[model samples]
Target: MVEYPHPVDIKVHQKSRFLDIAFDDGSHFSLPCEYLRVYSPSAETRGHSPATAKLERGKEMVSITQIEPVGQYAIKIHFDDGHNSGLYDWRYLYNLGKHHDELWQAYLDKLKAVGYQRKDPELAPPDVDV
Candidate 1:
């Protein structure tokens, strides 16, 4: 079995809308709340497979409301937008941090391809049903 580097410290910077995590392997990441929310591992977001994965939109200003530890391996992140199903495991979190740039760019590209315009949450129109 492989031993994964566990998180030694996790801090939620509410004001900045990002989570700072440090691992035992000398790795650290400052993950944006919007990024985490869009890349959530929940079935509603990731689905059962890549082909079924849903595209998350309108989350530019979303923030983390809370984070609950799931036993010894993962954490459940609660978003301010009411999404709280994803279980972010140690390895998965590490990978997200490691490949942040690429993953973020891919997400942006996907949104653009689907014709979704990202805009500031405050200036967005009220309750335009998708």
Candidate 2:
């Protein structure tokens, strides 16, 4: 069984799309929204098996639209893209926060190997016709 060390503070920096988590043990970490989005534990993201997990790209700008507490152990985060099924337990969140650098780099390498870009390239900027 996994246990989460209680956090002394959890601050969401909306502009940067990062979460600054401070633990009671005086450890702290800053995690990006893109990292959280790609690593979401929802079935839609992680799938039923590791072999079936779908690759998620174009989510570099994804942000948490809502964060709702689920009982006393987890948080339900709703993404801007309408995905809200992942239940991020405290322990899981803590682990992610602690191992963010390694996990994030691995994800980036996977994306690069697959030729996946984190931002959409098809959207055109609006222009006024003269």
Candidate 3:
């Protein structure tokens, strides 16, 4: 079993599209909803084989609609895009927070390599914003 810091608070900021988590170890992080969905533990993203992991794209506007507790160890995040299979355990969440920078950079690099573009809010028409 992987030992990890348990969360003291989990706050979903809809306006910012991020989940702020404070752990018992004094580590606090604001994990973006898009980041969570793209890196979902579900096979749809990271499968049994590394090569099977899909390069998630166009999720720039994705947000978590609900967060369901799974027993006492994990959470099943419900995304507005209908994804709810990823079970983010305490350890996994901790790891995500701890290594957010590197992970996010990697995802961006991968997307660039594959020519996958995430919807950019800045690119929106002047009349509307996403």
Candidate 4:
């Protein structure tokens, strides 16, 4: 059996909206909060399978409100947007980090294909639109 690497440290930088995770294999990933929110492994985001996956948009300003450990294998991340589902396991998180560039490019391509213009978080209005 393949031994998946385990995280040695994890830090949430709320100001920068990035989650930095360091694994035992000397690999590290700095994942953006927006990316994590959009790629959440929950039924609401991932659905039942890849064929039913949902594309999330407008999460550029999302931040990590909290991160709760699930046993020794996973962590549940809470976003400022009120989404708290999805348990990110070691293997899954590692894969996400390993393929960040490719996956991110694919996501960008999909958004472009649908003509979804991502708003600049610095210039965009708050989540609550009046």
Candidate 1 per-residue lDDT, tens place, 1-130, comes to: 8887899999877766778889999998988888899999999999999999999998988888889999999999999899999799999999999999999999999999999988844322122212
Q: What TM-score against the true fold does each predicted structure earn?
A: 0.89, 0.84, 0.89, 0.90
Q: What's the lDDT for candidate 4? A: 0.88
Query: Model 2 — which ten-residue stretch has the worst lDDT?
Result: 121-130
**What does candidate 1 score on TM?**
0.89
Report every candidate's CA lDDT. 0.87, 0.77, 0.86, 0.88
Q: Per-residue lDDT of 7-87 in model 3, one digit per residue for the tens?
A: 999988775678889999999988888889998999888987998888889999888899999998999999999999979
Model 2 score (lDDT) = 0.77
Which number leads on TM-score? Answer: 4
Cα deviation in Å at residue 75, candidate 4?
0.2
Stretch of 10 with least lDDT, candidate 4: 121-130
Where does model 3 exceed 4 Å of error? Answer: 122-130
Give lDDT tens digits, candidate 2, residues 54-95. 888888777777888888777888888788898988788889
**Which residue pairs come into collision in candidate 4?**
none
RMSD of 1: 6.7
Candidate 3 similarity to native, TM-score: 0.89
What C-alpha root-mean-square deviation, in Å, does candidate 2 show against the real structure? 7.1
lDDT of 3 at 39: 89
Q: Provide the lDDT at 93 for model 2.
A: 86
